[model samples]
Target: MRSLAFTAMLLAAPTAAQTAPEAQRPIAASKIVLVGDSTTAVIGGWGPSFCAYHVTSFAACVNLARGGRSSGSYRAEGSWDLALAEMRTPGYKNVWVLIQFGHNDQPGKPGRSTDLATEFPANMARYVDEVRAAGAKPVLLTPLTRRMFKDGKLQNDLEPWAAAIRKVAVEKKVPLLDLNVESSAAVQAMGEAAADRFAQLPPGSAPIGPTATTEIEVRPMAQPKLSFDRTHLGIEGANYFAAMVTRELAAAVPEMRPLLVR
Candidate 1:
């Protein structure tokens, strides 16, 4: 959900250019590579658990997603090049690239915003072409849903963004995983307060995400009950949503399904 408070917090002009990513470390070629913003990055989004649990021993799931990046900025920051480099690694006969964004591309995010109608679809299309050039399959996932609600119904401000991704998926003939639709349905079924359990929360507080781990991190505080994070996830939340993707991938990406854990 795009909120005024968050918008205001991000109004500070971005500083100097980001440093180039660290030197690439060679690892085994993976069957799938995930690319997106914080919502898919390790330690914050679903990538960690998605790779850990959903991937089968026969194949590796490499999550190359990073936080706070949008479709454009990620390429600008050289992360996309790094991702492509990984896709080019030898020893992997086939690979899949999962691309999901839009949370940071929404109306108010300063450094990460993209026009809903034009820039977004164009960016996605470019990614698909480049992934194909690298000899890997590309899968486009609509942005994950934010659990914001009003008047007992969920807000779908992100609908246009999801629509953009879907349009590109169809236009480009790429596989689509409508994570936004799936996640919104999941939240609606759980209700508001119950849905809050999926967010990252203060330590010792009960909820979704990695509370078992997040709550245990030491923060310097006179009192420890004040920290809260609603936009991220822990292991539990990741596992729950990762399962959603796996199920969708099974049916939607029939060929890739054989490589996933059943």
Candidate 2:
């Protein structure tokens, strides 16, 4: 009886020792920072849904994206500094930054448009370098597709910018989400009338206008008014694209899988 009792005690001792350390061990939390334009910003972009629904409590998700921001203006206006500060914050096990631009980077938008051939790629490479310098991993994302159709075919005006971003990702050897390709294909399959449902408001009878040439001059702390447009996202659009981002992110960075919801 004494030998039997001693063996049982030995087994229980190992179990308790194993579990005690695990119980006392701190859970390593990760931080995700989003940097981009209106397509990734709150209210008008997928960032809200991605943070609200896709991430688990084990992650700190910060959406620093803004409306009408391009790669150039985002840094010029001091937004990149804020994002970099977040990346440098201590105590996170891992930090990841997702960068998407291009809608406002196209020509004609003064103070925002970057020369696609030179400035755009250079800016992206700089961002990747800085993110690494701050001890965070950087993931590059192509711009979300604009939900516009011409003669039943989806118009992918952002392709040039997406190509530039892809080239940067390749040259930098960073993870690329290729959101433009995924989103453009998804929107094309949905067709014109179906895709219209993704707009912030119902698309009326008028034709979708050309891309806005001027950057939206919104106050720093005020919410921008949302109107019916192909460029901005509705809740449906947000949820849809947010799910895409979540899935693609999990795949692109497998270590993030445990922190994300499918």
Mind sharing the TM-score for model 1?
0.79
C-alpha lDDT of residue 143 in model 2: 96
Give the alpha carbon lDDT tens digit for every residue of 1-262 in model 2: 9999999998777665666754567789999999999999998899999999999999999999999999999999999999999999999999999999999999999889999999999999999999999999999999999988899999999999999999999999999999999999999998988888878878663434334435568434444466788889889989999999999999999989999998
Kindly report the root-mean-square deviation of model 2 from the true structure over all alpha carbons.
7.2
The deviation in Å at residue 99 for candidate 2 is 0.3
Per-candidate clashes come to 4, 0
Per-prediction TM-score to the true structure, in the order listed: 0.79, 0.85
lDDT of 1 at 129: 100
Off by over 4 Å in 1: 1-30, 202-227
Best by TM-score: 2
Error of 2 at 180 (Å): 0.3
